[model samples]
Target: MPLALALSPFLVLGFGALLIMLAEAFGSRRGGMALGSTIVLFATGLTAAGLWMYGLENLKGLEAVAPWLLLDRFTLFFQMLLCLGSALAALTAGGYLPEHELDRGEFYALLLFATFGAMMVSASGDLLTLFLGLETMSLGAYAMTAFRKASPRATEGALKYFLLGSFAAAILLYGFALLYGATGHTDLAGISKVLRAGAVKDPMVVTSLVLILVGLVFKVSAVPFHAWTPDAYEGAPTPATTYMAVVVKAGAFAMMLRILLTAFGDAQSMSWSAGWPPVLAGIAVLTMTVANLVAGRQESVKRMLAYSSIAHAGYLLVGVVATMRAPQQAGASVLFYLLGYTVSTAGAFAALVLCGSRGRETVSYEDLAGIGRRHPAVALPLAFFALSLAGIPPTVGFFAKWFVFRAAVESGFYVLTIVAFLNSVLGAYYYIRVLVYMYMREPAVGAPVAVPMRSGYVVAAVILSAVMVIVLGVAPSDTLDVAVAAALSPG
Candidate 1:
């Protein structure tokens, strides 16, 4: 395939991100027509079309367009997810803005840029490119989180996220520098070779590995590194929160897997499987246990959901650990979980959007009272999402968790598997509690009742997310089989 054709999806995303900036400059006055929605849809369409062409022409694996990027199947897989998630978020914001009187073009622009950044991260083949991509995505995300500049909590969330994210970024870059200094190469493939040659045992390499793990741990919200998650998720704009929860983590983990599989995949290094696996296993155990236990005690629905998201991150780390121990099937499980997570979380957030008339609710647990009686559509979808998060059967989350556990048990990581299973049972309590409030309790007197669904974007997002969750949950065999085939064999 032609290089331009290979690079089209990313280039389209980049141009689209910039286009939104241009539109912001010139189109600020014309905010009422859902122009933000239009731009996102058009960009998403462009991305889908480009990827379709690539697939039709048998374009798979890395297509090196520069020293920085490697357009490959792995990258395309995440790129498609990011674009779809971003489009869903845009539509969500579209539906949400009008009701809240905050409909503005810049909101869509930030969403596009954030997605574009995620695309860059997936496509990156070099550390410098990855760092650049991370910053682009992070910066855009911070802006979106605080888009409600008027809200003190929103501003506070943005500041906390930004400060902490900046620290993580710096640590990651330092780690990259150490890797480069030790290996004398910046490309991922080269780093793996250097490490395997005994260079990674050097003190510099050891320091670099720990620092790099710290940075990624922060990204994945692992225990001892997850303090900012609940606050940020609660304070950010809900649509932004959804985007961060789904797309950002997915993108970050994609890179995390790539780095582990490529740059660090050297049995001779002693750090590849031996070093990281136990560390991750420990982190996963604590992350799952702590997040779920804390989540169960939260009074605010949004805060509780935020903790649930953190626990899910721990579940994903289990999949990552599987990559080291059971390479082929485990990697596929990670991708599956990411897709499942994106769909379920997006659907759940859409329900939250419906409940609030202007922006999100104060979101007290009492706010959910009588929703099941008054608004079946919103209430049921929320219930489905909560069930999905809890890994209940007949939901995609069940299959996602099942695969990870299967991979772990196959690799003889019985203890980790058991802990994860127990966490799921613990998590179900809080997830089900929200449902109980919605269905069993009486509506708080004069609580805001959900209005009718409005906007094509809103309807599309909800329908698409709901359908995906059910279909994937019921018959994930096809997708899982394909992902298995595509996954690289563990080192």
Candidate 2:
């Protein structure tokens, strides 16, 4: 295949970013940028699907980029997920920006650029490409976090994220350098070969693995590395928050999967008796338990969701750890869970966006009082997504958790699975609280209540997300089959 045909998904996004940037510089009409970005993302998704249909293994010249940019089923799967998530976020922003008086063509440009970075991260196969993609993605996110110029919280959040994110990036780079020193290679496959050849016990390799895992843990907002998440999520514009919560998390996990399985996948390194599995299990427990406990106490719904995002990461980590014994099942479970998570999270945020208009935006639980009685269109979806997040029956979230837990059970992590189930029960309280405030409580006398905003963009996003959540929940086999095909072997 031609280079352009082989990299059509990435090329489309790259072209779209440049086009959006140029339009921002020269055009006065800012209204079309979001639509254009969404169109670009949809086109990118189509390209990825086309490649999958065309048989990625048969694409000529694909190996020419080997160990730097891999365009296999795994990469294509995340490309589709990233594009879809970013598109929904763009649609949400179309309404959110105008309503909040932050409308700017550059916002869309940044979104496109950030999405391009995430695509790169998903496709990366070497440490060089991986670091490049990570920084590119993080820089755009930092800017987006602080996009609201006049908001002090935005500035604070951006500053914290920039400082901490830069630090994490540096640590990851140092780890990569150490790995290179230990194995004399930057490509993950090469490193894995070296480790399997008898260097698994190298102190530098262990240190590099620990440092690399730390950087990735921060990206996923897991436990102690998660200090930046809630503040950043709450301070950023809602649309940007949605982007970070879904697209950014998905990209980080994709990179994590590639690195851990490709570079450090030796039996000794993946072992439950002495390796990443145990460490990740501990992080999973801490992340779920801590985040859930803190989330229940948050007054701001957005902040609560931020913690919710962290808690979900813990659940995904459970699946990640299960990969040691059940690579295919666990990997597919993680992918499907992320798919469910992306839709459910996007819908939840979109519903939150719809629950308020300009000057009456919802923030606190008090603001949501009586919303379900007045705005069934907004309230119903919000309730559905909330329940989904809590992993209730007959929703996509339920199946997502079920798959992950099932994988863990099959892998004999009975204690971890039980702990995760308990965390799920604990998590339900906060998610249900949102619904309780929406349907059961009444606003205080003379207090301003959030009114539903009217925007076709937001409505479309909510509908798209809701439909996916329900449809995938009802008939998951097709998606599961695709996920199974995408799973990579540790070797």
Candidate 3:
């Protein structure tokens, strides 16, 4: 394959970001930016699919950018995932921004740029590229969090995110510096070679590993590092929150996988007796338990979903821990779970977006009271997504959890799996509560009820996401096959 073809996905997104930025500055019409962003994202996804079909490793000149960016099945998988996620977010924004009177071409531009950064994160093969991608993604996210300039909540959330994110970045960079000092290598593969050559016992190596894990855990919003999540999610525009929930999380996980597997996959670092798995398992248990417990207490629906996102990250961490013992199956499980999670989460947020208009947006459980009676079209899909998030049968969320737990079982993590299952049950309570409010409860007398917004963009996103959740849930073989293939061919 031509080098251009090998790099098509990245090129397409990069170029699209530039074009969208130019359009935002020069174009008169704001109506088309969302549509334009959607088109670019779809095109980028198709490009990744094309590369996957062509077999990324077989392509000549793929190493033209060797040690910096990798064109692999894993990268392609995340590229497609990020593109689809960003497109859905863009569609949601099309409805959400205008309804809330914050529509601007720049929002779409920032979204594209953020997505481009995420793609870079997935494709990165070197620490330099990874850090670059991380900051790029983080900057866009900070701006998006502050998009609602008139809202003090938005400003506070953005400020906290920016400050904390910068601190995390500094920690990560210091870790990288320590690694370089210890091994004299910055490339992940080179660092791995050094470790495998018997540098693993170095105290500096261990310290660096601890620092790096802290940084990555913060990015994923794991427990103790998750204080910023609910506030940011609740304060940002709905569409931006959705993007953060899916795309940003996906990118962070991608980066984590790359670093851990490539640079720290040695026996000492990977061992359950001594390595990262035990730590991650503990984090998974705490993240799931804490998030679920707190989520059930949240009065705001969006904030509840934010905690739900953290809980799902905990589930993904279970799969991550399993990778220490069953690399292929556990890794595939992680990819598949994220695929299911991306659609289910995006759908849930879209449903939330549809459940409200400008002044009457759904916030509390009471705001959703009688929504099913008022608009079954909106309520039905919301119910489906909510049930799916709860891991109900015949939904993608169920299968996703099944795969992760199966991987854990195969890896001999019985206690962790049991705890996760119990947490899943606990999580269902909050999700089901939303449905009960919508279907069973009635609004208080004279209280403002949430009204469904009318927008083809939001409806399209919701329907597509819901259908994907169902289709992938019912017949996941093809998607699973792709995930397995990607997993077997590690970056």
Candidate 4:
């Protein structure tokens, strides 16, 4: 009964997806799937909200479920966060899909399926379930990225994302095999037991750990493994890109945190070499520095944001690295940063969706000129979101950084903290440049542009982001407590 309750949202989402497929196969019109999708998204949102409240009610004593999934505080917390992020992205897609000539019922179905898979990944207690959930999410995302098949850019982007994503998946699976062979178990807890048994001096253990880290690094867009992010983000539909940037990152990070806490718990094991800490630390520095510098030089705003996403990944990794060094601060900082990241990123993407003109492909920085005068409503939100991304104070991003940096400092990683702070300064240039163009520059005469009047949902996304940015900034103790509880779970 407990396991069933824990899995309710995923089951609901899958059923909704099946309903969409059935509608597509049997309905007379192509829009049947679309109708099915809207209903499914709404229903899934309601279910997720209910599940989240229930999980909160039982956070103190949440338990593992069926050896495959864990229904503890951590999983439940992330499950809710990912669901809310996905729900907002779905709402944004609701409007953007119809406007871009890409409306299809299957799109919504796929989105729900991806969300369900992401939730599973966060809650998974074993390697097999994690891999399964990761693939389900990736497959759905691949299709959605290419939803605008008629556009050359979209098709090209989807192809690149698919190829690279498949390669990453293969690497992860191979790593899983190596791990199972070395540890004689597929479950995370079982593997941890083997690793902590003082006999993990074998080279095979090290090989498994390295392979697994390499595979996961690619998923989170760490430097030297982030080649696919910019092209995919630039090429995919904007709302889909938002989902990738926000929910996908959160899920991958959750998995990374779990692996560190459970599978690699024993520091003396062959799998826990001192080399990994420095290596990860270096990767975080390289990712933040390179991405911030490169983002400043991009002509396309979407591509710039793509680089920004990579930079944020670097920041998140700082928390992961801190966790490896000092477990306690790692938990609170990681979850807090993820929450701040999801809201700020969703708001940024929503602003982009609002900027699209009818029958025009949205791209480039120059496209936003003088929007402050023309569309104060859109411009204000975009500015706020951009400022948040730049880590401006009183915004969510600032507090997010504070949490992570404080964690890093507590862990005695002064060097990583300095690098992160400097990178944020570098990141500010491009983000502020967007605002400069939006509010300061003159609109080019005869440049075709249309700003849609605000919808309640759009206003709501902006308000939610802005309000949370402030609230979380001022009263982060409760949120931090929740994240800390989740982090200390025994699965």
Candidate 5:
């Protein structure tokens, strides 16, 4: 295949973003921007899948971008997932921005551009490209977080996210710069070769590894670095929150996998007793424990979901740590979890968007009281998604967690697995609380109640996410196969 065709996913999204930017610059109507961006994303996803089928190795001229951007199965898999998640976020934005009187064309432009950055991060094969991608994705997220410029919460959240994110980026850059100074290589393969050959124990290498790991763990919203998540999720528009939860997290984890496996996959560097495995295990424990405890205390469902996002990061960390002992199984489990999470989280957020009209947003539990009886349409989808997020049986989220836990057990992390299992049980409480309020409780007398809004765009996003969640839950074999292939693919 021609390199352009092989690279069509990146090309389409890149130029599509520019076109959307230009259109927004000149056009008056904002209605078409969302559809345009969604179309671009769907096209990118379809093309990436097609290239995966065509085979990455068979494609010619890929060397033109060698050692910086790769078209491996891993990259292709995330390309597809990011586009799918981004498309859903854009669809949600279509209805949400208009209904809230925040209709601005730049939102779609940011969506497309942010997705472009995520795809870059997924495809990055070098330290420089990774930093570039991280910044691109983050800038768009910060802008989106402050989309509601009138709200003080939005401004504060955006400021915090940007400042903290910038620091994280600087730390990551310094880490990789040190890596280059030690190994004399910025390409991942060269770094790995050097580390494995010698200098694996060099003080610089050790320090860089820790710095990079901290930068990555922060990006994933793990504990000790998750102070930005709740405020950002609470302050951002719901669809933007969905984008961060799904697309941005996926990209960050992909960055982790690529950097860790390719550059630090040496036995000594990944060992359970002396390396990142134990560190991540400790982080997984803290993240799940802290996030679950704090989430249960949240009166705002949005804030609860924010903490839930952090908790899920811990679960994914378990799978990452499991990669120390079982690379293929653990890696595949992580990929599958990300896929399931992308749909389930998006669906849940879409339901939140549906639960609110202009003035009566679904912020607190009381806003949701009697919602199941009054707005079955919105409540039912939330129920299904909430069940999925809580990892109930016969749902995508359950399988997502099951595979990760199974991988952990297989890796001989019985105690760690047990702790994770207990954490999940604890996390379920907040998820179940949603249903209880929606079905069992009643709004206070004379209290303002949420009136479900009607928006085909929002409903479309909800249905699309719900269908994927159910289909992948019942027939996960094909998706699992793809994930395993990606896991076993070239690092």
Candidate 6:
């Protein structure tokens, strides 16, 4: 394939973003901007899927972008996932912004740009490109977090996110500098070769690993570095929250998996090379345990979902650790889980958006009481989404966790798997609690009124996500095959 053709996904998103910016700047009518953004994202995803069908290995011009952008099946997989997830967020925003009177063309533009950056992150093969892509994505997220500038909560959350994110970026940059100094290469393949050859005995490499790990885990919202997550998720607009929860996180996990596997896969002998896995495993334990415990205590539903995102991060981490022994299965499990989690999470947040209109936002459990009885249409999907999150039968979340836990067990992490399973059980309480309030409880007599809004965009997102959830859960062979192929393929 020609290089330009191979790069079509980037070109379409980049050009589409610029076009949207121009139209938003000059055009007074912003009615279809969300739809436009969604179309561009769908086009990007379709192009990526086309590349997957054509096969990345058959392409010749890929050398032109090598050691920077991989353009592999793995990258293609994540590109499609991010685009699909971001497109849903765009659809949600179509309904959300207008109903809340925050409808502006800028949100769609930022969403496109952010998704473009996430695509870059997934395809990045070098530290330079990785940092650039990560910051590009973060800047978009920070701006979106503060999109509701009139609200103090939004500004506060944005400030916290920005300041902490910048610090993490700085640490990551320093780690990259040290890594380059130690290995004389910024390309992940080169670093891995040098490390495996044991050419570098520099203590700086160990320090750099810690720094980089800190920065990476923060993006995934893992514990000890997850302080920004709840506030950021709670304060951002619902669509923005969905983007952060799904797309940003998928990029982070992609970044983590790539960097760890490519650059530090063989930093030392197989005896806990670089001492990363044990450290990561410990963090996973803390993340799942702490987040599950705290999530159940939250009064605000959004904040609880924020914590839920953190818990899922921990679950993904377990899969990462499983790669030490069961590389293919573990890696495939992570990819498949991300696919399931993407749709499940997007649907849940959209249902949250759907449960209340501008004046009747669903803030607490109390706000959701009797909603299932009041709006069965809205309540039914939310119930399914919540069941999925809780890992109930026949839902995607059940299979997602099952795969992860099975991979962990096959890898000989019996104790870790048990801990994760127990944490999952504990986590189910909060998810089930949401359904309970919606179905069995009743709102207080004098409580603030909340009503479900009607919007074609959000309804489409919910229905589409719900269907995807069922398809993935019931018949996952095809998706798992694709993930396994991506996992086993040479990067």
TM-score on alpha carbons, each prediction: 0.93, 0.99, 0.99, 0.92, 0.99, 0.98
List lDDT for all candidates, in order: 0.79, 0.93, 0.92, 0.79, 0.92, 0.90
Candidate 3: regions farther than 4 A off: 488-491
lDDT of 6 by residue, 137-162 (tens): 99999999999999899899999999
CA lDDT, candidate 5, residue 177? 86
Q: For candidate 6, report its TM-score.
A: 0.98
Indicate whether candidate 4 or candidate 6 has the larger TM-score. 6
- What tens digits encode model 5's per-residue C-alpha lDDT throughout 79-100? 9999999999999998899999
Identify the runs in model 1 with alpha carbons over 4 angstroms from their true place: 28-67, 268-273, 359-362, 445-453, 489-491
| Residue-wise C-alpha lDDT for candidate 3, range 356-454, written one tens digit per residue | 999988988889999999898999998999999999879999999999999999999999999999999999999999999999999999999888999
By summed lDDT, which 10 consecutive residues of candidate 5 come out lowest? Answer: 482-491
**Pairs clashing within candidate 2:** none
What is the TM-score (0 to 1) of candidate 3?
Answer: 0.99
lDDT of 1 at 175: 94
Report the C-alpha displacement of residue 213, candidate 3, in angstroms.
0.5
Inter-residue clash pairs, candidate 3:
none
Q: Write the per-residue lDDT of candidate 1 for residues 138-164, one digit (tens) a residue.
A: 898888888888889888888999999
Predicted model with the maximum lDDT: 2
Question: Distance from true position, residue 459, model 4, in Å?
Answer: 3.8
Per-residue CA lDDT of model 4 for 1-491, tens digit only, reads: 65556566667778877877777667677644433454565565566566666654553433555458876667767766876677667667766776776767677778778978888888888999999889988898888888888889888989998999999888888888988998899889998898778535667777877888887888898898999899889888877898899888888988887776778766753122453566778889999999999999998889998999999999998988887666777777888899999988888887777776457544777778888888787778888889889998878798899999999999888988999999999999999999998889886788866555434555556676678777876787888886776674322
lDDT of 6: 0.90
- Residue 49 in candidate 2, Cα distance off native in Å: 0.6
- Least accurate 10 contiguous residues by lDDT in model 6: 266-275
